[model samples]
Every structure is written in C-alpha cells, then in structure tokens.
Target chain A: MADLATFDVQSMNRVDLVTVSGRIDSSNAGQFDEILKGIVGKGRNNIVLEMNGVSYMSSAGLRALVSTLRTCKRNRGDLRLAAPSERVVDVLKLAGLNSMFSSYPDSVAAVGSF
Target chain B: MSQVEAVFPARFAEIARICALVQLEAAAAGFDEKEQFRLQLACDEACTNIIEHAYGGENRGNIRVLIRQRDGSFLIQLHDTGRPFDPSNFELESSRQPSADLAELQEGGWGLHFMHSIMDEVRFDFDMDQGNTLTMIKVHP
Candidate 1:
C-alpha cells in the first residue's frame, strides 16, 4: 500500500487548523487519524477541520473525524467543521453526523467560533 | 477475466476521485443512478475502512481494487494487506434509530453497515497465504 494522500495542519491563535484534501477511504483513513492524533497530542484542543477542498469522504473518513472529536472532548477541547463540499456534506448528513459537530460555512467562521 | 486495477496512496483525497471514477464506470455499464449511488457508497465505505484500519494510521500499503462484470451483476474486489479482521462477522446497527444524543450518532461506526446495506452481497476472506480480500456484488435494479 503506497501513501494514499497527504494532509496539512496549521495553527491560528488557539485553534488547531487542519486542511484535508484528497480521498479519505480505507487506504488512507488511518493516516488521517494519525494526523489528528498529532494535533490532539499538542494539547491544542480547539480544532477546525477545513474541508473546502476535500473532494470525497467515506465512513472511514467520518470515523476519523468522530474519533478526533471524541479525543478533543475528553481533553475539554472542541472540534468544529468548516467548508465541506456539497457531496461531503451529504455523507455527513446521511450518516446523521451533521449535527454532531458544529459546522461553519468557512474556516474563518469556524476558527472564530472558539 | 477482464479486470481493471486502480492504485493510489492511502489518502482520503484520492479516494474521493477514485470513487467518482468507479461511479462513472458503474453508470456507463448501465447501472441506474440509484444503483450507481449505492455501489459508490458501498465502495467508498469499504475503501475507507481499509485506509483507516488496515494500515494502522499510515499511508504505507496498497489497496488493490478489481472490478468485473459477472453473471448479471458487477463484482468488485478490494485487496489489502492490512489487519486480519473480518467485516462480515460484525453486527450492523440500524441507521434509522433515533439517537438520544448527537455524540451517539457520530460517523465512525457505519462503514461496514453501509457497505452491507447497499451491496447485494458482501464477503471478507482473510488469508495469511494471500492477504485480506473484500468482495462485494451489486446487481442492476
């Protein structure tokens, strides 16, 4: 299995910002999870997942997000979502996860939420 | 046996693009939009599970995807050398149940359930001899 894709994490103020682009599926979902784990490990609890460029997501991707949220909650931090494409948003809604995390139209608003 | 194989790193961005390709191929092969969507969803779930669970948090393996038309259905097989867990043995909870809390409905545990729900048949075979294989079928409706 080759590296499926890459993700970038940035920090702004108290927010741990993550920008994920590429397919999040069985092949790379674990890597995505590990990226999130690294962020959580830094003790920066307020998270904003910026998905404006994410073209697709699978249940595995959703799982990574959920797991990250759980981790943040355990640390008394919060995870927020931003700028998911229509297709990505549909999956979240279909899985009934739209309301599980706070979603903003873009990263600025998402980061501002904290 | 004519087959097509797509190889990509263990990343989410590529999964989305490949899923679109798979959906297009399924539709061109005469699957209705609804059926195509179902196949796409199932494939996405399977592939995503492999990415997250198989490689154990790294993009360091291959997810070999094979698709063929057989009998009156499209047969899809995903081959991965990840962990040896079987998806077939897992009990899929219903998606229709209303949850008392939003956290209970978070997105992590639905990959197997979604694949099982959408595909006509889903099977998993773990072979130390050959690796892990997940085979699924979707028939034209």
Candidate 2:
C-alpha cells in the first residue's frame, strides 16, 4: 500500500517550506496541487519544497510542481527544491525539469537560495 | 501468460487507483524497489497523457490498463476512449539528457520523456473499431 500523503508546511520570513513526505503519484497529486496553490494563493510565492521524504513522484506530481513553479515565477517569486531523494531526483532529471528549480543539499541552503 | 485487467473512468482522481494496482502487480512479480518505481512511473505517465490530452477539461471517458507477465518480461497496455494520439510524436529524443538550463526548459513534454526513459519498450496503437492502446514493456532484471 502507498503511504498516506502528508505535507508539513511552515511559513518563514522569505519562503514557504513544504516538507513533503510519502508518495506523490496520480492518486493524491490533486491535493498536492491544492496545497501549493493555497500557499501561492496566500501571497507567498517563494516556496522551498523539501523532498527528502518523498519516495515516489509520478508525472502527476511533476505537473503540480511545474504548475506551481510557473505560478510563483509569474509573480516574480521562485520555488526551490531541497534534498530530493534519489528516485525523486531521477524523475526530475528524466523529465528535464531538474534545472528549472534551484535545488540545494539541505533545507537551510534551499531556504537561503530564496 | 499471467494477466489482470481493469477499466476506470477517465478522471484525474482515478490515477491513484491505477497506480496502486500497477504497484501490486509489480510487487507480486517480485520486482525490486527500483523496478517497481519504474513501472509505476512509466504507466502513470501514459495514463496522465490520456486524462490530460484525450479527455481534457471535465470530459468523461474510460481508461483500461492491462498488466501481463509473459516469459521474462512484463507487458502493460493502456486503452482509452479519448482522443486519438499519435504515440510516435511522443518519442523521447534519443540523445537528450536532463541538464538543460531551467529557463530553457518547457513545462509539459517531460512525462513522455520519463516514460520512454524508464521503460524498456514503449509503443502506441490506435484503431477506430477499438480505441487507443499504449503498450509498455519492461524486462525482468
């Protein structure tokens, strides 16, 4: 069974730190999009997505991430990624979207990038 | 050949159920973690394309995914009653790696790349009498 999806969201001075745990597949990608949308909707554009706890990411997840990235960028804000698991990195790389987001080794570095 | 098949309404929400079913098959086939992830991702990408493209914007349709183990390989076929997509157009560029600058990156298009990259074999077929079928094959490691 897939782990229940959860997002640990924090509001920081510069960015919204979203610590995503469990699998992000087609199953719950809609909810994931909504969370990101809600964050951006609240006028917080710069988002630091922590992916260390993300075990699986499907194309649906990528769509949510890219859509969120586009939304943030349109507002002159950016979305950075932090500590993606090997599988997450592989999916991002395979999709050629790895370079689209600023990625760091840790959350501190990622939050700093913003 | 051992096989199982299911049909789902073409809704974004159904993607989770489809993927979960795929994972079960992969696990029962004794696929390693990496292999299971690959299968799940590849199949998920194909289904997403159908939901987003063939049946875009609250359109109602049906998607059927079939998984079969034959010989030393796994075969996955996705059948959908949405728009007819020429799967050939989705072919991943043989030489394209994922290192391009983000500014140079495009938003969509990556799902097909990921599908082709992860699966050992991917093909598409369309028939007016039937529907669209996307075939993805992965060899047992």
Candidate 3:
C-alpha cells in the first residue's frame, strides 16, 4: 500500500530542509508529527518545510505543525514554511496560525531565513 | 436536488475516503476550488470528531454521512451511534485566537472551530432513537 504522505529531509549546516508531499489529515498526522519530532530529536532544531506538493491540510495537520513549531522554538530555533499551496495557506489563515510561522515564497528564501 | 449517502467504519484511516466523497459532491454542487477545499476540511474534521469522540475509539462504531445539494446550498449530515457528545464542551478559547505564546495554546478544539468557520450553519441534534446528528450547511457563493 502506498503511503498517503511522504517526507524527505536534507540536513544543512543551520537548518533541516524537509520536502513534504501528499495529503495531511487525521489519519497521517500522527506520522507527520513523529517524523518531525524525530528530526528535532537528532539535535536539529531549525526546520524549513517545503510544502509545494501538499494538496490538503486539516486541523489535525495544523496540530502537528504547531507541536513541532513549539519544540523547535524551545530549542532557540524555528520552523519556517516554504511554498505552501493556496489551500494550505487558507487553512493556516482560517486557523489563525498564519502569524505563528514566517512563510516564504520558495525553499531558497525559507532556508536563507534561518 | 442530488443526494449521496455512505456508511464508513469509525477509523482514522477512513477520513481521507470520506473527504474524497464530500469533495465529489461539493464539486458537483458547483462549488469553486476554494469552497471545495473548505468543504473538504470541514468534512475531515467532522469525521475525525466522530471517530475520536463519538466512538471513543476507532473501529468501535460507524459514521454514516449524507450529502445533499439543494436550493443552492450544500448540506452535510453526519450520524454516529457510539455515544452522545456535545462538542461545545470541548471548545477552547485558544482555538479562536492566534497567540504566539506556546504555553497558552490548545490543540484539541481546532477541529470544531474549523468546522464552524468553514460551514455557514452548524447544528447538533441528538435523539434517543435516531442517534447523534451534526448538520452543516454551506451556501453557494
């Protein structure tokens, strides 16, 4: 069975660039949270999420993102979003979380923000 | 008017399938891409609430959904038989407010908030004989 979401992570000197593609809903949100936690657990706190391929995100997905963001910020680092789809941006706005994380238009900008 | 009904097992894995079904109906009802996306998110959160709160656990019960397109509005009624739950009891003030302080944030109630924000009308009704029903309506824009 093919997975509903996939995450590919590349570690940089100051940030971890994670390219994510697929739908993030209740079913796979736990998996998403675990993967992010794993990334932070390995002594990498700064994260740049490339979300060009994310087609959908529900409140459950937002929960995972919030949890990860809190963890990153606690370690004096941050989680930045790059190239989110329009739908994802709308969701973040509706959830009143658009101001929580700084968003960039592309991965280069997001990575450079760190 | 067009209508579609389906029963799904109350499991986390079934949320995407449910959303897909709603997406089809929403698109058929003349919802634009943005409205369809809102419907999908509302549907996803509603089903998740059923599985997690109404059923108390996954696979313990079933979620029956009815989608209807009528009179320039999209209507969704979700029925669950596991338990009677008043979702307002779990409402969090933080869900409606965006705060940068992590300590004051609450992650649980955003699902209900999303459902209410996306749908124009949201109502919950419970009957001893008919089970719990959550009816949500979105007016065509």
**Of the candidates shown, which would achieve the greatest lDDT relative to the real structure?**
3
Which residue window of length 10 is worst by lDDT in model 1 chain A? A1-10
Q: Write the per-residue lDDT of candidate 3 for residues B23-104, one digit (tens) a residue.
A: 8999888888898889989988988988887888899988999999999989999999968876567455324766667757
Best by TM-score: 3
Candidate 2 lDDT, tens digit per residue, A19-96? 998888766888999999999999999999999999888877887888898889989999889998888887877776
The segments of candidate 2 whose C-alpha lies over 4 angstroms from its true place after superposition are A26-31, A37-45, A67-78, A99-109, A112-114, B57-59, B92-99
Error of 2 at A47 (Å): 2.5
- Give Cα-based local distance difference scores for all models: 0.75, 0.83, 0.87
- In candidate 1, position B118 carries an lDDT of 75
Off by over 4 Å in 1: A1-4, B1-21, B30-38, B47-88, B92-109, B120-135, B139-141
Clashes of 3: 0
Give the residue spans of candidate 3 off by over 4 A. Answer: A1-3, B87-95
Ranking by DockQ: 3, 2, 1
TM-score, one value per model: 0.66, 0.82, 0.94
Query: Candidate 2, TM-score vs. the true structure?
Result: 0.82
- lDDT (Cα, tens digit) per residue for candidate 1, span B40-90: 778877776777777775476888888887667788888888888654445
| Model 1 clashes, total count | 27
Candidate 3: what lDDT? 0.87
